[model samples]
Target: MDAKQYDTLQQSLSPKPSIIKNCLKAFLVGGIICTIGQLITFFYMAYFNFTERTAGNPTVATMIFLAMLFTGFGLYKKLAQFAGAGSAVPVTGFGNAVISSAIEHKSEGYVLGVGGNIFKLAGSVIVFGVVSAFVVALVKLLLVTVGVTNW
Candidate 1:
């Protein structure tokens, strides 16, 4: 086929995406996830004697644990398919990615497969998160030293 004809055929064969529908699905799913997290944080603050700042750690850990569980049970993939980027823009998404990799590699062996590959997708995230936090702290320290901001 000629280039122009082939391009036209490809365009005709591909299904068009509905941008508004996808956006609405993503917004609803992502909002629900965030609301669940907020509820967890408040529960901790109210019942566990955790302050707002201290409550965040447990809330994040709980969310990650739940995400990992969902990933293991193969539910997160279905959710991702339905929610698109909505299921992937949170810390829970990071947990899902890491656990999914491990599950995929679990067949080869525990040590060489699951353990080795578990961090493949998440290592960059960890390294970058640590580096970014360090950089931000350094900038804060510099600002304090220069009297641009107070500690």
Candidate 2:
């Protein structure tokens, strides 16, 4: 009836979360995803004659493409459900977000719906990445100008 009574009732009715178990699951799943990415990087370096530095771009593209395929097949949903933030803290998650938005809006037509909405979720990520890179570059430039660092 009273606010305090309702609060107590809600607290008592809620189930306790298994923090340790959830964290273990997330850690394992995230580690596996990163390992897969690393393997892809190695493959590119070994087979495509790409150096370690040059392999990074192709590795990232491969990971994102795989994520988009999984999202389209509805497999990423299950993985996200099971792995929680594990499946979401990687570059693959960005691909999943872009494709999922497009798939959800496909019914309204390609240009107005899919094209316009495809980047709805990923736009913030892109902006943040660009801004962060600019800030880091500015800092590096200042440091270089002051003779504190080299290019």
Candidate 3:
């Protein structure tokens, strides 16, 4: 396009409030998720008598389970509605994606319905991540064998 037209379009599309608002929203949501995790850790230790280490790691697992359960029962949708990425960026989000997909496909019978749907979002990611790790390890070994270890 001509320079004048390009400049006009660029000015028209220049950064605006909508972009800033969306970014602030994302930041707030992420902060809220971290805050929720902290609260869970505190409560686990205070109320459940859990040790510090157990409370930290296991609360995350528990939250993931609850997110899956809620997604299965269609409750997590509301949580996402309220918390936005705050709720959807964690392990809980992974659970929600998995359970929701499984529930969506439940009418297709056991094999495809239950099994196929379980890992719809996460399955491929997990597989590729593991495979890529193996490749990276092999490369590292080869590099070490060649005496090129100091990168």
Best by lDDT: 2
Candidate 1 on 18-136: residue-level lDDT in tens? Answer: 88998888899999999999999999998998998999899999999999889988899999988887898888888998889899999989999999999899889899999999999
Alpha carbon deviation, residue 110, candidate 1 (Å): 2.1
lDDT of 2 at 62: 97
**What TM-score against the true fold does each predicted structure earn?**
0.82, 0.87, 0.64
Any residue pairs clashing in model 3, and if so which?
Answer: none
Which sections of candidate 2 miss by over 4 Å? 1-5, 147-151
| Candidate 2: clashing residue pairs, number | 0
Rate residue 48 of model 1 by lDDT.
95
* Candidate 1 weakest ten by summed lDDT: 84-93
| Better TM-score candidate (2, 3) | 2
Query: Which candidate model has the greater TM-score, 1 or 3?
Result: 1
Better of 1 and 2 by TM-score: 2
Model 2 C-alpha lDDT per residue in residues 4-63, reported as the tens digit of each score: 999999999999888888788889999999999999999998899899999999999999
Best by TM-score: 2
Instruction: Report lDDT (CA) for all predictions.
Output: 0.92, 0.93, 0.79
Arranged by TM-score, best first: 2, 1, 3
> Candidate 1: RMSD over Cα atoms?
2.6
Q: How much is 50 displaced in model 1, in angstroms?
A: 0.5
